[model samples]
Target: MATSGGVDVGAAVIDCGSFLIRGGLAGEDSPRALVPSAIGTRSGKNDVLGHSLWGLPELVDQVVDVYDPMAGLQAIPKWDVMKKVVDHVLSKHLMVSSKETPLILVEPSYMWGVNGRAAAAELVFEGMGLKSFFIARGPVMAAFSAGRSTSLVVDVGHQGAFATAVFEGYALEKSKQTSVLGGRALSDYTYQVANEKAGQNGIRARYELPSMSGATTEKESKAEGSNGVVDSTAAVSKDTAGSEEKEKPKDGSQDVEMEVKEEAVPAAPPGEVSKVKPTTVEAPPPAPGAVVPKEGVAKTFSLDSKKAFYRMQIVHDLKQSALSIREIIETPDPEANGGGPAQTATAAAVVAGSKVKREPRPTVYTLPDGTELDMGQEICERIPESLFDPRLLSDSKIPGIESARSLHRLAYEAASACDIDVRRELFGGLVLSGGCSLFPGVAERFQREVAAITPQMFKLRMVSPSLRQDRASAPWVGGSILGSLGTFQQMWMSKQEYDEHGAMGINRKCP
Candidate 1:
């Protein structure tokens, strides 16, 4: 059992999917913990938890075997699954904290107003032990490691990218901040373009990246590399391969470029795939079932590279425009009305030299060692060139960091209230957190832009969190420091006090 005066400790940070819980027995001991957000259960064994195998002779051992009770929350919150998780964790750690030890847990800011959290927290405390404390808001915790006083925090994870700007350690109101800025925007942006490119021709393929999956284990591409993004759409069958090759004019001919619409290109048809070579063969967006080589053919009509180039141009516009909009929104002023031609042109820029005049693009997301994401940044870029918003690929980009764009522009209302100037000797250090700052080039790129935008007299630098550490940990970092002090009666209230004065009292103590 954990005691305040003893070294025993139980601490956890819970995100949407997983809980990273760390525990130690004494002041000298280190925390041993893991956060597995998923609950996998065998089908048909049972649909619920605590369903009672109490008297069944055949179920005696089965009761002991059940792992996660809150397994299926697709239909319900499955608070029971959470209970089973704690039990399973304690069993592994050999701790007697479930009924005697105290716990300090963390969660997201959005959970504050929900009634479910109150009940959930109660049940967890009741099941484990009444001596517990809660500290929700992990992005704030991760930012703590940055050792900064004020900064933007971007927490990009599996389910989505979330961003938060904290000033003087206070979590600002959503009304005071703009929403629709983060990773889901990136994923959605990437998905629409990928979908259009793959659907171009008649080849239907699966995407490699799982929907709502791969936040932690995926490869390090500030965005997409083999580990970052996969084209499951290319999960081609043996028959599918035979068709792609058969469709390619059987003769090995580089002279014949078979052009198709942005919608006609199949997803990575596995034949000789050179790095996405630019081709102008546009064949009137091939008829349904009309087999066409995604790249070139041996015999027949020369494809229109203009259309392909047109697609690439579209991608350029989307990336640049989206980038501009995010910058404006990130630094918005109360009197600001909207955007202008330069902002509009950012999305409209296209690559030159091709038969089709289109916007240019940056090299796509790269692997850790810096390999081009070979996925489809180019192809994806192409689709956005021509499509307007409301068209799916129609990159309106206003609410999109989620959108794409460039750093070029000349505009300002009242400069952002939060843009605190920093002298290198004092506050040049910017602390980053939130869910959106997770994009690859954000920090480095933002630094370059900020320097360009600011008066040259002030030098600036931006930093990202240590990889794999949660942004939410920033607050926990501060909490960890707070946790390791004299037995201060001021910071935490006793559970016994809660028994007398209740939940409201608990908030008052910490609030």
Candidate 2:
């Protein structure tokens, strides 16, 4: 939605993910600005020419690099970096003042505690100086986006994948289970695979750590499988140990931290700018130990874009592998159940012993370096196999997801954990959202696996966004739909209320 610089503009809906930030007006069909949840910077100054520079290598100049504030299960660890990213979204990209416009933000389901939500509210009301705001759970928002009020939301996003059961627009906090095997895990696995391939050919592949370069004095490396060649100009990796450690319930026990209350909370009340901004500013030459690549010096480094493609391939492989683990169950037709012509035909086919013919489907990807890599069915099928049966992978321990559960198990467990009265509804309304859910055959495989384990009395129905639907931005869409509602305005925890109650009141007003 286009908006002129003015006061009291329409409410802005922002879905802040660990990977991407999708935001726009409350009534817009889609987010007008979709940017990477990253901050680009150069030394001596925090000026990142572009607000979103995930894949635009050409637009990049100088010793510029991007850093993700929320790299793991811990979201929004860097308050300053997040502030800059959000400020750019509101002031520059949206072209409206955030201080005036009411805002609705979608947060990850896992980050639903005093620490995450309260800190976010502080950022919005106190930090951004916004008057009104609303916080919605990522999976709940995803369920809303899928046109359902109650659903078992299986969202596979950038940071991780989660199975959250939402009943009547309320998230079943106890039923929410997450896995570390998300986009990052897939990307890291891809890097490992690529590094192994490069090693076999006696080639060196150095992955430019997006967050480590540019602004910092030294490059930090986290390369797996690649030779651990320490650069003299590089600093020790800044990544903290156990960054991916998730606060999961002990022994996979279903425990509800917060009870779902059925009551309406009182409604409180609702960057870059220019292209000539010099992609690379004039600066003094690098210091002796500066990590920035020497000017005019050609370097052979793998781009993040190429690695993203590998992640997609891995996602597809996971879908195929999960599907392969299941045995197809054929149900008898109604006519076949009774003595009829269909039964006669079925008998004949069984007698004939006919076999179904199938062929392997190869996925081909073109790398950024203008090279084509064709992943065979066997290899692609093996990639995602680790998700279901971790024993298949040598390094089964994934960060964040200490105890990885299969997609089928996650959904089934989420559904089973719900109240008996809502179990059928949860099972029937299985909503799949997020980037990995877009992979082909994922929904079908999930349906099959869930059906196999589901009791005979219960039927399994899986819901997924259409091909044309923006699955990755579903949470933002839900926030948009929600923020545009006349009733939704009442739910906002106003600046007046925040002034009186402070951050602790967020749980009461917004919850």
Candidate 3:
């Protein structure tokens, strides 16, 4: 709760992006509910929506079709789904009635031209029946979060990146620049590398099974001895082991060896030949909503759409935990041989020369099947390099990747688009905000790259927050600050104003 004019404001702030929707009360240090910006609908039933499918168990047992309402920071396409999401957050997470709370909605700069602000106003005032609300641009909020009224805010989020120049807390919309490179693109590249490695090493997908009475303890066990009960040893093995013989069950179901702790069996009586053997049973069908297993034999298995989606989640975690950017870009020495290109050097030597220094040890990520992946520096550094050089993504299948400019170029161009008097200030107050910008060494690298292209007379400075969480949710933090200010209490657009002027009134009121 926050106070304005000695009264409890009870304002709510929602910052919804392509990947996540962050919602919380105003004046809070961080968002209370950070859920995925997606809703799941069962196949053939698009009207029925599931709010939080991030939990694995909920996703199992049904073929869910995941849809993202905010895919590219544009105007939301699925207003119905968006409304449900808002309700879920407000009532379920924030425990506040929509009609009682004043809301601040954050939107991107590009959406301002497309009537996105007015549509959002309609959703808040008419759809949700909120009393009052304000629409704030994401870049301006990010600048505010960084404690600057004037800054060049570069936000690299899940779907795309944008560089906006702000002056006195107002975004210079004409000077805004956008790029296709973002956190999801880098995560996709990391997934490619990890998938290839898993294929080569015969790694499988593992999942934690729900606990049942009389279940075995937390130890590696064989799935065969579960006696028709689904246990923690269930695993989905990939078809990586070439030429391995696989047993086919008579029921036409795949037989996968479950990795679970072996149950103790009574010793056979009087040394008679014990006929007990590992029971072979029908494996769980490789279908949508099938539970992932803990371990399995080295055999081929089809990856259902659900499994692929889940694996992407694992890759996303690995990217966040293990990825790092190089402080300095590595390039081959041009004057190695008599001030000429090293044409006589071998290809391996040239590649070695261009390689950035590796970390002392590779990051080890364990898969669900207990296989450790050695995510070396080469993979970690190369994925983020695409942000600096769009050419690195020329071969990638990601749409619009080739059309994107590097982050440095984006910032420089955005500042150059502004007036000459403000260009220096924008350069001096560069701010990095968003999940992608939280990468270690990203700010330093951005500053270096911008300085290389910037004019000699200009001075460049980065005003990024020291805390990672602050940087990732900078816009939401800014909105939280603005909503709690006593001075800002008069700024919200009331329901009466909306009724008189219509949805388009938000532009005049919020802007």
TM-score, structure 2 vs. true: 0.69
What TM-score would candidate 1 get against the native?
Answer: 0.46
Give the top-scoring candidate (TM-score). Answer: 3
Per-structure clash totals for the candidates: 85, 3, 11
Evaluate all candidate structures by whole-model CA lDDT and list the values in order: 0.33, 0.53, 0.62
Superposition TM-score, candidate 3 onto the true structure:
0.72
lDDT tens digits, residues 1-511, model 2? Answer: 2253553456888887766666678877777665555444434433342221322221123224444456545444455556666676665456677777788888875664776678888988888898888888888888888888998888877666788899988888888787766655654554455434433331111123344224322222221113422221122233522222111100000010111110111111001111211111111111112233322222212234233322333333323222222222344444332322112112221122223334434345333333345544554555455555444444633443456667777777887787878987887777777765544445555565565466654545656566424676778888888887888868999999998998888888766
lDDT of candidate model 1 versus the reference: 0.33
Runs in model 3 deviating more than 4 A are: 1-9, 43-52, 56-59, 73-77, 109-114, 200-305, 328-361
lDDT tens string, model 1, 82-129? 655455444333244455654444444332434444545555555456
Query: Each model's RMSD to truth, in Å?
Result: 18.5, 14.9, 14.8
Model 2 misplacement above 4 A: 1-9, 49-52, 55-61, 74-76, 199-374, 385-388, 400-402
User: Judged by TM-score relative to the true structure, which candidate is superior, 2 or 3?
Assistant: 3
